[model samples]
Target: MKRLQQLIRYSTFALGLILACSFISERNQAGAVERPWKVRAYIQKHDFLAEALRQETGIPKAIIYAVAGLESDWGRSELAKNANNHFGIKSKPEWRGLEYCKPTQEYNGQQMVTQNDCFRKYPLIRRSYEDFGDFLMQSERYAILKTLEANDYTGWTDAIQNGGYATDPEYAHKLRGIIWRYQLTKLP
Candidate 1:
């Protein structure tokens, strides 16, 4: 009788552990499923503005959307939420606007490094979008993007990565993946 009781106790403990592990696994899988939905929702919320900015600035809407989505983590990053900086536009010395400081990681050719960086802040989300458009239009490094056709998202991504817009070596590939995954290339 004593051995049976011990066996039952061990079995119950094992069963509880198994149940807890199963719950954790299910939650993780649910998170994976929910992420694409979040990206889709982010795209839905900002697609019209992306199209408008493209029309006004001559940048491809797909490129704008994919870049913003990737940079901002589907509008869920701290910079996007706190500063409305969807494109991760860092604050330059010449920037006279409000700034938000946060820790960020950048690839420095050798490896990734973390540093506290200041980023531009905007009062409205629209201002963020407008500033991103103006940023591309005014930067000589990105001038090549203007020559690409409006729907050439892959070309724009390559140009942006080549122009040193991001330190990530896989920046262009990641942008292309996002553009393709979300069908952003269909945007006008």
Candidate 2:
């Protein structure tokens, strides 16, 4: 009986070691350094954008990060493809007042064709935030967000959902998950 118990203990130790090694190997394979580097670069590029939005709208930087992280994966989203509109906001009829770009698109799997679509661009990151605020403020559907302008992420989430910003049912939960996972509410 003593030998059997010893054998069980050794097996448990080996299993634990294997599990730990597997976890570490998976983390390394996920490109850990690249993940942090991408997030750091995103903040460096758009810190001014967050500041500008804060000045105009009183939204917290953490909330902004949460939104950006979920939408664009710290600006590494495949949707950008290159043009830098990381939020996946498609140009629609409501954006008529904003500037339009002749972006190429393949409709229903056809050849690329030019379409007049609204996109926000800025010579500076500050201007991008200013334009984003303007876009949000101008939309009647987004009026619910106005009440959430000051440091309320739950409110912001509900407002965005109410405004039809995303149909993905998990968007808010995912954003909240990222916010907590990164502890984005904490100081840098």
Candidate 3:
């Protein structure tokens, strides 16, 4: 009878542990669910500028939005907040504009390494979007992306990734996912 009581107590403890773990998992999932709403809000706030830039530069608005969204963490990154640099455009030696220096992580073929990098700082968010368009237009490496249809965000993402816009091997995949998940292609 005593052994039976001990077994029941152990089972109760295990059950409580399982319930706690399940609750924690649900909380994490809830945060994931909330992220889409945040991204959507970001898109809504910036879609007009993205569309304007797209019309001016012929770069797809979806590509612009997705790249900015990913690079800037939906405009919540320190670079975006402080520098208005939504595209993560690093400072070049020839850059004659203000720069913000910060520690950033870059994949070094083997692993991500943190390094101090200087990024362009913009007086206005519009300037940041415009500079991103200019960067793509002027870079010979991304010239292939310009020939694709304006609505072909997938092709553009693939070309941008191929053009070494990011070190992440899954950069195109993530951009495509963001475009699809948020229906960015439908934006004007």
Candidate 4:
């Protein structure tokens, strides 16, 4: 009888451990929605950024898609949901010297509400793309990018990751993978 009781106790403990591990695994994988990089989304949502990218960086549409895909998986990123904060610009609370203003329904495009908060909104993806480009141009962090501006999307990406835009350990690797996957360097 003692041996049987011990066996049952061990079995229950093992079952509980398995259950806990399964729960954790499921939680970790849950809510991971993949957003495919689409040119149209960029055209509609980030048109302003898109144009600026072309004009300033001379990078084509395809390259932008590849870069954004690796960065935020085409803007379906978890962080993107909050304040449309792609490119992971950290809050500069010290820059609170900037003015604050309320947004109106008609006030479209990216606007800085407070020194620390910026909202990027667009009626279409193209607008979003262009606005994103302009965003980097205007931001203090990427100001150096403007000066060294060339069509070096690869270099731009590396600089962005190195500049502490994101804490992701594999950010640069993932970005490179996406860039290679789509061969954005060749697309006109």
Please provide, for model 3 over 51-150, each residue's C-alpha lDDT reduced to its tens digit, 9 standing for 90 to 100: 8888898998889988999999999999999999999999989899999999998887848889999999999999999999999988999999779998
Minimal lDDT window, size 10, model 1: 28-37
Best by lDDT: 3
Model 3 alpha-carbon miss at residue 76, Å: 0.7
> Where does candidate 3 stray beyond 4 Å?
1-35
Give the Cα-based TM-score of candidate 4 against the true structure: 0.45
Going through the candidates in the order shown, the clash numbers are 0, 0, 0, 31
Query: How many backbone overlaps does candidate 1 show?
Result: 0
- The alpha-carbon lDDT assigned to residue 64 of candidate 3 equals 90
Q: Work out the TM-score per prediction.
A: 0.78, 0.60, 0.78, 0.45
lDDT against the true structure, per candidate, is: 0.87, 0.64, 0.89, 0.55
In what order do the candidates fall by lDDT, top score first? Answer: 3, 1, 2, 4
Q: List the residue pairs that clash in candidate 3.
A: none
Q: List runs of model 2 lying over 4 Å from the truth.
A: 1-35, 78-81, 96-128
- Tens digits of lDDT, candidate 1, 34-120: 237887798789888887897799887778888899889989999999999999999999899999999999999959999999999
Return the TM-score for candidate 2, rounded to 2 decimals.
0.60
Which residue runs does candidate 4 get wrong by more than 4 Å?
Answer: 1-52, 56-63, 75-119, 147-153
lDDT of 4 at 30: 85
